[model samples]
Target: MQKKCTLITAAAGLVLALGAPVVGSLPAMAATAPTSSVAAAATTPELGSGGHVFAHGIVTLTSAVYDQGRISVEGVITERVRDVQINAGHGYQAGKVGAGGRFSASVASDSPTFELRFGTKYNAYNFATVESVLWSAVAPGTPPETPGPRPTLTPLPVPADPNPAPEPQPQPEQDAKQPGMPNVLAVSGTDGGWTNDFETGAVESLFTAYDHARREATVTRPTDGTLHVQQSSDGVTFTDRATYTAGGGIGKFTDIDVTLPEGSSWLEYKMWVEDSSGRKSEAQKFFVQEFPARN
Candidate 1:
């Protein structure tokens, strides 16, 4: 489902709502706070971010930054959107749109494949997914100059060169640790996979949907305030079944057998984080297919 482009990064494919392109380094931060370091990157990669307007101009993702495995995002959400949240893997956080029509939230991941969704309580929303964190590990420092607003470029014809130098190929992601490497180049995170799936996909992808019979899903995700695990029979409409806040950090929350309501074929889930006031950011939605019975 991802488009093909040599310069494409998951940040750029933010459904194009983002104004700029972003790429991250491999051999990223560990599960806990970024504890180790790696070699400096050949070129400092741009921080994953967004400041563009989309959704008929009602929603604006002010900023979304991904470094190592931690993802932090700030945005100017419309008042219609009562809640704002970010979720990757099982880790998710929620916040209400402030009086100024803006909200800020963050989440952590155990893998590189993470996605950020900003939306209202209703279906109106926008999404930014980090398909894969590419590039070398580096420390946070001065970011490259952000390009000006989208410019209108007129395509012009040019004479073709008979002999052009071979384009340099990008280096592969490093799987092992680097001795002198900094945690990773973060755009805004105060404290956060550059190897294997961590560099190639989101933490959510690292986890599969719950196996109804077993009542247990794969992988463990981080949690802060509270995590709401809701199910949908049709994958569109969803209802709350259980709430979890007892356990902290990354843990298996969906460890119950599904009741399997009538007409339930596909099992879909959406995670929402609730604040102290019970306010939840009805942000992103993901589903785990109910695998067919084994012979």
Candidate 2:
């Protein structure tokens, strides 16, 4: 039997596994802006001689959450050809993540970090912020390269309903999950204030559960933006809960004293952001658990 537990609520409205449809009016577009110049963008890395090639081995890439976490990342393999610039020939290799849950990339460079990148502003929710994992070739005719722990900092304390017994509703269809990535829950205790080293890539914002006692959360962003916290009762319709602003080019803040809706013991919270350019980011959702309480 599944053990029923309430979501630990936090200030930034970070839920564990919940989602809400986007609503409200769109922001106004800029009036008259100057035309920006376009440069030949380097989408992939350039390859060169004396670089590391893929030996007879397999390099596996795993998702932080699940397989179908709605997250699409590219494994970038780059090598320095010239003294300063890395752009040259096929010095870089990039490949799409296969449906069979394989993140195999044949790197042609001697030194390459198999980094996962989701182009700029392409937000990733309910996934890992530090998406890149490094791999080193073992030897010829050896087993495929084993993946080490992806460099991921701790996530902030996520929020959920404080009340234990809220009325339940029909659950929605779950997000598609990768085959290798399975859904599991684990709880542990630790001491100290909440801390999370957030990573940047395809994920613009992230919410994680740290300590259940503190009931607080911290949000960090690379650019100036506005963070909005929202809550939901049925895990479908959500209303505005709070708003925060990060001025300057970057922002980092921690929120406290987050309260849930009256008469609702089971609530799921999510967060969304608007960058300085008024561009909205994808919402980050968390999990919500609603099950029968044991007598």
Candidate 3:
């Protein structure tokens, strides 16, 4: 049997001779991307600022201007795919001047000839003109193009089964309440009704809570009071929802909350109140503040 040489070396002496550090020496550093790649990825598309195409529809009236008041022009709309409606009174006369002054009249269905006119009092030459003919189309059943960045749809997370049972499902949030006309309260102090504190100059209330998303106004009243509130988008027919009792006084009063829609510049709230003795209050007008959503 050959004699084996047993050489025992200490760990410290081995490390010093080899000039190598131990295994657990220094902390690790985080990984980072290159600065150039980061800057390039941060770039975004620039939206066009000039005029662009609005809708794909034949122009019933090509750049037509309304010079004389109450002037009517007849034209035919060819290849009428969608509802070819004329927007006569939209630009400057929305809900302000009478409907006859500025308004849109729908062209007859399947008829090539359509008539358009201005109000009798519109005498200013080149005052108004039809900017464009607006219409809608029923698109065929197909997958629409994806807008903006590709959305990473995350799958619903599921918990592991404890006893080989089915996983629980996530519940969806309740649908928002549909908008409706606000309630109208009668100002009669009779029948356990409370009188409206109209001692102040003017008091008005709003009942409808709008999300400013759907862009539909179906006003509805929330509570019972002596203040009568109504809703109207066209300003022609007013829908009464709530009524408040007037505590024998002379000043005007109202109680309502006006929730403005998103991207809206202004909101108009109209109220109609009456006294106990069948005295109708003047129509009160309230302007809503512009509200923008934060990212």
Candidate 4:
């Protein structure tokens, strides 16, 4: 009876195993199907170099902040020549061929320094170079007039519900003049004197008086004429130090070096001109100031 019972139990277990489903087999099939599909789609495409071959690969150029960066051809050659020459304007040249090949060089930190151009042509290929690339910390294509440390801004405190009315504008300062003054010419720092020839007359007037601080002055005359002005420590003595002539009415600029006497405090200037009609114009004061401390 015991043997018969054991045989019956074994046969029942085998029947149950054949009827039940297999666990974890479905997950294996699902994973392998997607993996094979992904592998098939990941094939790498081959790149061709056409007739010309680059041994190091393609060159790329880029810039940072306010700079113009470039990549040009460079390398040594045995058969054909490969040379770069700079022209008058910012120009350049580059190429590769025959027993020689091409290389690439970046624009160094010292930019706007040299022009560039290519040498003789070995084949029908026409190679050309690029022009100037300007850079600065402020903006692209803009250079700073003076280079120095960057500036930082400080925030101001805001008033709480400040309902302040607008203040009245102040009257402009009256031009100082003496009695019987004739042929008055007015000049100011804010005026566009640097680009105008009036600076000549203005500078000349300044030098004829007193130049306390040894500051240099430049005067560009109208009709392209230039006059240098120098003055003695005592306001009485003045000199027309030098002059430069140009073709157009827009005169060239001349620099005037100042040499002041030690311990001088104040300096004054006056300018006058005589016309062909024997009429002398009244003298006009140009610059007056106290001497700055010596460094």
Q: What local lDDT does model 4 show for residue 5?
A: 6
Mark the 10 consecutive residues where model 1 has the least summed lDDT.
186-195
TM-scores for all predictions? 0.25, 0.16, 0.15, 0.16
Stronger candidate by lDDT (2 vs 3): 3
Candidate topping lDDT: 1
List per-prediction Cα lDDT, in the order shown.
Answer: 0.35, 0.27, 0.27, 0.27
Q: Model 4, stretches more than 4 Å misplaced?
A: 1-260
Candidate 1 wrong stretches, greater than 4 Å: 1-50, 111-295
The number of clashing residue pairs in each candidate reads 15, 24, 40, 11
Question: How far is each candidate from the true structure, as Cα RMSD in Å?
Answer: 40.2, 38.4, 42.4, 33.9
**Predicted structure 1: lDDT:** 0.35
Task: List model 4 lDDT by residue over 84-108, tens digit each.
Answer: 3332234333333333223233333
Weakest 10 consecutive residues of candidate 3 by summed lDDT: 1-10
Instruction: Give one digit per residue, the lDDT tens place, for model 1 in 1-295.
Output: 1111111122323333344332231233211111111111112333323333332333444444556776554545342445555556684466556775566666676543333334333223333433221122112342544558998899999989989989999864554323332221101100001111222112222322222211112321123311123233222233223332222222234334332221113333444443445554443344333222222
Which ten contiguous residues of candidate 2 have the minimum total lDDT?
1-10
TM-score (C-alpha, index-matched) for candidate 4: 0.16
> Model 3's lDDT to the true fold?
0.27
